[model samples]
Target: MGRNGVDRDRYQASQSCSDRFQGAFGAPRAEREQQFSKFMEHLPLAVSIKDKSGRFLFANEFMKDLLAADDPVGKTLGELLPPEEASMMAVNDHQALTQGLLLIQNRVNDTYGDERIFETYKFPLPMPEKRTLLGSISVDITERKRAEQALALKQQQLEELNRSLEQRVQQAVDELRQKDRLLIQQSRQAAMGEMINNIAHQWRQPLNNIGLIIQNLQLQYEAGEMDSEQMATEVGKAMDVIAYMSRTIDDFRNFFHQDKERQPFVVNQMVSRSLDFVLPGLKNSGIDVECREEPNVSADGYPREYMQALLNILNNARDVLLERKVKQPLIRIAIFRENKRSVVTIHDNAGGISDDVLPKIFDPYFTTKEQGKGTGIGLYMSKTIIEKNIEGSLTARNVDGGVEFRIVV
Candidate 1:
């Protein structure tokens, strides 16, 4: 409005309030001009007017404080601002002159060297003498921009975390499946070894009987007493023993068969079948075994796994009896129903397990036997089969004079 400074008279002459508010509000020229100057000085927004050449013609009090400049009038943006910011302002001024209106968002450093964002509106104003001025108002938007940036970063982090969690879960599932396969293989290996030992014990008596029958036939022939009826009788007795030995193989095969489905089966029957495979060894070892069966007690689960668990317990009992060789060695199996569940208890008199060793008996790879003699997964797998697969429980405790293993289904 004035050269080298703001001239009070020139600034007052530029006020067009009277023309805008004529009949509705009447006031003296001086009074209206003072009101306009006061209003512009107190406004919160940064307001300024520039010539077509991007030179500041007028700047409000807020604009002066925003730029930290002593006087902005008659100064070009290039002279008043840093090179990069001046260049950006120059471009915006040119667009406002050519396009009539321009709106933009920009980043700039304030007088304190702190960064700030501004949403600016620029428009052209035609003056009386064919001259044009560009007017602009800007509001700080730094907080809003920072919030948007922070929200975007958080969303990205959450997505990456979700992906990482999915990968970890899949890896865990794969590991569990591998462990299951290993357990099954180990169980089969243990069962196979037990079967071989039992078969040896089972066949020994029948083989010796056949040998004796052959010896008897020789003796009869030498004496000239061999008759057709006597020969048939001797042969029939030998065949019966051989047939009984053959059935042992069938029993072993059925015991190891993998069952795919669960069904209701008598608990006592399953326990008896498991004992059949080990009875010969028990007899030969002179470890007396007695079964006290209770009728009509049934369960719903994998019968083969149930049998395997029972066999493992029995085998453990047999081993302890033989290893310790307790006087009058005895192992007792009892099956009955209690609390609406089938229960089986196997008790052995071998001085029971030591207090320290009893607690860890069901832990995987923990064995009392020498390294090559025990796979240790037997009791652990048995626990898994009963608790997880069969939805039942297996527990061990020291009784009055022996160790008791109990299964509840």
Candidate 2:
């Protein structure tokens, strides 16, 4: 499909998500007012609401400012935006309303005539009187797109350089070593983005707590209840949250630091530690993850490199579940010893990959994800690390409902 074309799939929001904003029955009036306030003022993403008749019902400040509109409500797309942009949005809106939730990429030139790309999620929002309105959350992805394009160009240049070097130097060992260095460099670059996302997940709750603490202090002060005990208590709570965030940063920094030499590590312990880096994001996505480990299993290798491989596999599982919108998504990890070899298996219930794609899953630059979302080197580097660097075995198979990856060292 072309860049302008929509890549769509059926979507239903999860119950846990629905419960957050609306319980089994519905949100209370006061709670809904608070949500409205946050949605309109605090949200940084552009959001819009449109009725079936194509007249805008409402738009958040971000969306309004983007369009430079005095007021968007009661204005049709054709009346509010440039014809080409309006037409594109109108078509997308219609599809979202009729066909269920849609994730689409759109390029638009706002009133200022500056073009920007957006990654938008449009869904049908049920309303009072059994009415349905189109709701959208759009995030500007122009910078992210540019970064992906640059990374792709750099990868192409590296491939060309490698070809030239292979022709000039006939030493097989040296060429292989050079390729390994480049692979590690590329893997780190790709993994860094996900690590940052994990960092955000690690800090989200603490940040929210700190914000509430500040709000409480304000309320207490205004009500003349700000005693020394309360003052010390709130300040302490804020400090503790700050400390936790600091420790999270330290953990991430250590995870990414290159290992200088091989080291002995406990298998179960390493698996637990590896989960720490990614568990937060996985849970936030509502994926159920369970670890069943037989303790005391040991392995000898570069622990950091081994952890990187685990990160790649776990991330791929998460992406698959999210992309497929699988119900009750679950990832189960088991660690044990088989035939005196330390074994770790990770499996997920997202539908298994196709037969034709399974054999090439470990091949570099082979990805099933849409453009700019995947570099296709993660699994390749992962297999290389386990089999080559760690001298371990990594294999994959299609289980009954999903895929399983086993690692032995």
Predictions in order: lDDT: 0.84, 0.84
Model 1 scores worst on lDDT over the 10 consecutive residues at: 4-13
**Which ranges in model 1 have alpha carbons more than 4 Å from their true place?**
1-156, 212-236
Model 1, C-alpha of 32: deviation from truth (Å): 18
List candidate 2 segments past 4 Å from native. 1-170
Best by TM-score: 1
Tens-digit per-residue lDDT, 1-409, candidate 1: 3463334322422553334443345677667657667877898878888777777767888789878888887788999888988998899899999998899998777888899888989998776667667888998888988999999899899889988988888889789767966896788779889978989998998999999998999899899999999899899989999898889888888877788898999998888888888899999989899889888789999998898898888898888778777888999888898999999999998888889999999998888987687888889989989998899999999996999999999
Query: CA shift at 193, candidate 2, in angstroms?
Result: 0.3
State the lDDT of candidate 2 residue by residue for 53-126, as single tens digits. Answer: 56666677889877788777667899987788788889999999999999999887767788889899999988
TM-scores for the candidates: 0.61, 0.56
